[model samples]
Target: MKKFIPYILILIALGIFAGYYMYNKPHAETQGAKADITINPADLLAAFELDETKANAMYLDKIIEVKGKVKSINEVEQGGSISLDTGNEISSVICEFEHAASIDGVKVGDEVIIKGFCSGKLMDVILVRCSL
Candidate 1:
């Protein structure tokens, strides 16, 4: 039993190391990557409104390029969020940029195309790691 103790301890240490490595792994670069889907923001919002679960299964973790008019902008710690009007009064596609300064030229009512990963949806469909 004493001889097996060291082996067990080594195994435990290795398991911990493996978990930490995976947990800290850097995310892949989404910038400059070709979008998997290009669609109007209004259409995208409609899909989510119709079927959120299905929309998430199809779009989540996938890069999408959306074109729309900016409705609002809000700065955050990580960067900022741009709400794009989706031809709807209630919902919009919210694109979260990594750096607020990166969206310097963007403003309300500007027509722009942005690409990002479709993370999920709340009151709005959420896109993260957005870039022009």
Candidate 2:
């Protein structure tokens, strides 16, 4: 009985350690998740008020999400695409999704929130996800 008691205690301790490890382990979706910081295009435009060239230079290859209205829908040989107005007075912001068909339900002039990673000056944003 005494020997069994020590074994039981060790097993219990190992079980607790396993539970804590599982509970604190990083999730696949959040392993490299970007910071939750967000900047509204309108506010960013108003604050920095950068021209297209400057804005392009600043936001290129950066991770950002912008909320705006859909200005138009376009279809190319590659795939469908949507343009978003960043509430910028100078130039409209554009976001292109690899699979534009996913956004088929969205139409011109619909308000939407878009999250993506910025690619370059062309506002070559990759739409990670979006919502109306």
Candidate 3:
């Protein structure tokens, strides 16, 4: 049993290092990055509405670029979010940014293209870590 002590210690140390590395890992840069899937806001919403399971398998965690008129703009403590009109008052594509300043000049009714990672559908389709 004593002979395994050193091995156990090494394993613990390796685990700690791995955890720290993963915790501090940088987020993927979305600016100027090519999107994995590009779709219109309404089309995206329709796809999710039609088949949530299939949409989740295709869009979740993948970079998505959508072009639409901004339906609303919102600011949060950490960043900002904008909702793109999806032709449905009840649902829209919400894009989130890490920097509040990212939405500084943006306004509702403005047409813009946003790129982000598709998170999932929750009434609205959510896109995180977005960029213009």
Candidate 4:
């Protein structure tokens, strides 16, 4: 019984930890409310251009606020995607808004601020769960 007691305690601790972790899942609203960093779209793109791996380490999975000029916009059934000029003709910051509920009146050439999780560069910086 004494040996079993330690095993039982370990199980209980693990169960508690699992419960706590499950309770704290990532949510967009909460993440947008608190950005880890704020930077311009051009600067963010420049970082990746200089060193993709290093930039990924700095921005990946982090909530970031970016301000830039709108390059283009595309609407989809679910929502939409906005491309912000990164000062590079080839690449831009693509912000994916899972729900375009609030993207009314937005147009090209307009400057906007976006907050989302950085998913690293793929020819362009991708930001998911974006909010204006």
Reference-based lDDT, each prediction:
0.91, 0.59, 0.95, 0.89
* Superposition error at 27 for model 1 (Å): 1.7
Best-to-worst ranking by TM-score: 3, 1, 4, 2
C-alpha RMSD in Å of predicted model 1 compared with the true structure = 3.6
Give me the displacement of residue 116 in model 2, in angstroms. Answer: 1.5
Residues 1-132 of candidate 1: C-alpha lDDT, one tens digit per residue: 899999999999999999999999987656889999999999899999899899989999999999999999986878888999987888899999988887998889999999999998888899999998
Query: Cα RMSD (Å) per model?
Result: 3.6, 7.8, 3.3, 3.9
lDDT of 2 by residue, 15-89 (tens): 999999999996233114563436765554543344656755665455566777887777755546667766554
How good is model 4 by TM-score? 0.78
Q: Give the number of the best model, judged by lDDT.
A: 3
User: Which stretches of candidate 1 lie above 4 Å from their native place?
Assistant: 1-25
TM-scores of the candidates are 0.79, 0.52, 0.82, 0.78
lDDT of 4 at 34: 82
The segments of candidate 4 whose C-alpha lies over 4 angstroms from its true place after superposition are 1-26, 30-32
Over the stretch 21-54, how does candidate 4's per-residue lDDT look in tens digits?
A: 8899767562338889999998999999999999
TM-score of 2: 0.52
Residue-level lDDT for 24 in candidate 4: 96
